[model samples]
Each structure stands twice: as structure tokens, then as C-alpha cells.
Target: MMELAVVWSVLIAQTMLALAMAFALYRMARGPRAQDRILGLDTLYINAMLMLITFGIRTANTVYFETALIIAVIGFASSIALAKFLMRGEVIE
Candidate 1:
């Protein structure tokens, strides 16, 4: 019974994360401004990272956690670059 409950919970969480990702994609595509689009992209990355972590928990595996970490690092770097571009029109000096 407990195992069944765990499975159901994981499924529900994954479904929710997928829905969130879809909404983020829509926001990114339908944005009225660059800032809105950037925000959407950041939200998408965050949702993806969360989904990965959930997968790690469901599977009781370290591989998924490691992948999520990599995604987090990449997402952070990309968000910083996007913010720099927005503020200074360039990501690199």
C-alpha cells in the first residue's frame, strides 16, 4: 500500500511539472516583451530541474540527481547571461 501511494504521488507530481513546463513554453512563445520571454525561459528551466529531482526521488537513483545538478548549473549560467544581455546588451566583455 505504501509503495502504491508513492507511485501515485510521483505520477501526480510529474504530471504537474509537465503542465507547468507547457505553460512556461506558451509564455515564452507568446510574450509581449523580451523581459517576459526571459522570465518564461527561466521558469521553464526551473520546472525542468524540479522534474528531474522528482524523477530521482521516484527511482531512488543518484544519476537523476546528478543530471538535475548539471541542469541547475547550466540554467543559472544562462539566466545570468540573459540578464547581462538585457542590462548591457552583451553577455561578454
Candidate 2:
């Protein structure tokens, strides 16, 4: 019964994450300003990472966790680059 409950919870979490990603995508595509689009992209990546972590938990696997960590690192870097570009018109000095 506990296992069944865990499975159902994971399923529900994944479904919600998918819905969040879809909304983020819509914002990314339709945002009127660059900042809004960047925010949407950031949200999308964060949700993807969370979904991966949930998958890892559901499967009791380290591989999914590692992948999620990588995604988080990449997302953080990209968000920084984007913010720098927005402020200075370039990512690197």
C-alpha cells in the first residue's frame, strides 16, 4: 500500500511538472519583453530539473539524480549569461 501511494504521488508530481513546463513554454514564445521570455525559459529548465529529480526518486536510481544536477548547473549558467546580456548587451567581458 505504501508503494502504491508513492507511485501515485510520483505520477501526480510528474503530471504537474509537465503542465508547468507547457505554461512556461507558452510564456517563452509569447512574452512581450525579453525579460519575461528569459524568466519563462528559466522556469522551464527548473521544472525540467525537478521532474528529473522526481523520476530519480521514483526509480530509486542515481543516474536520474546526476542528470538533474547537470541540468541545474546548466540552467544556472544560462540564466546568468542571459542576465548579463540583458544588462550589458553581452555575456562576456
Candidate 3:
């Protein structure tokens, strides 16, 4: 039953990832301020990247790991930029 356990684990991980994504989207849409929305976006991207890693494991595709890393870097950069803008009143200020 090892094969069945593996299948169930993958399925459960995927479902949890999907629910996380949906919650992030809801937060993004309902957030009361720009910073909150940006935070939600960052959360969504991070969760998506993690979901990609899970998919990679399930499908035995190493390429997805690289993609997830890239997405994580981009998400971090965007969050930094957004936070800076919030503090300075302008992106470049």
C-alpha cells in the first residue's frame, strides 16, 4: 500500500495548496489597503511557488524547482519594492 499512500499524500498536498491559493486571492480582493493587498499578493506567489515544487515532486520534473525559485525571488523583490513605496510615498522616493 505504499503506492496508495504516495498517491494520497500528493493529492492532499495539492488540495491544501489550492485552498491556500484561494484564501490568498480572497485576502487580496478584500484587503482594505494597498499594503495589505500587496502582502496578499506576496503570499499568493509564495504559495504558488511551493505548490509548483510539490507538483515537481509528484511529476519528477526538476525544471519546476528552478521556476519556483525564480518566482520566489521575484515575489520577494516585488514585496520589498511595495513596502518601500509605502514608507516613502513613492517607489523611487
Q: Rank the candidates by lDDT, best first.
A: 2, 1, 3
Error of 2 at 17 (Å): 0.8
Q: lDDT for every model?
A: 0.94, 0.96, 0.91
Candidate 2, residues 1-93, lDDT tens digits: the string is 999999999999999999999999999999989999999999999999999999999999999999999999999999999999999998899
TM-score of each: 0.94, 0.95, 0.91
TM-score of 2: 0.95
Off by over 4 Å in 2: none
Name the 10 consecutive residues with the lowest summed lDDT in model 1: 52-61
Worst 10 residues of 2 by lDDT: 51-60
Model 3 C-alpha lDDT versus the unseen true structure: 0.91
TM-score of decoy 3: 0.91
Q: What is candidate 3's CA lDDT for residue 12?
A: 99
| Clash number by candidate, in order | 0, 0, 0
Better of 2 and 3 by lDDT: 2
For model 1, residues 1-93, the per-residue Cα lDDT tens digits are: 999999899999999999999999999999989899999999999999999999998889999999999989999899899999999998898
Question: Which regions of candidate 1 deviate over 4 angstroms?
Answer: none
Ranking by TM-score: 2, 1, 3
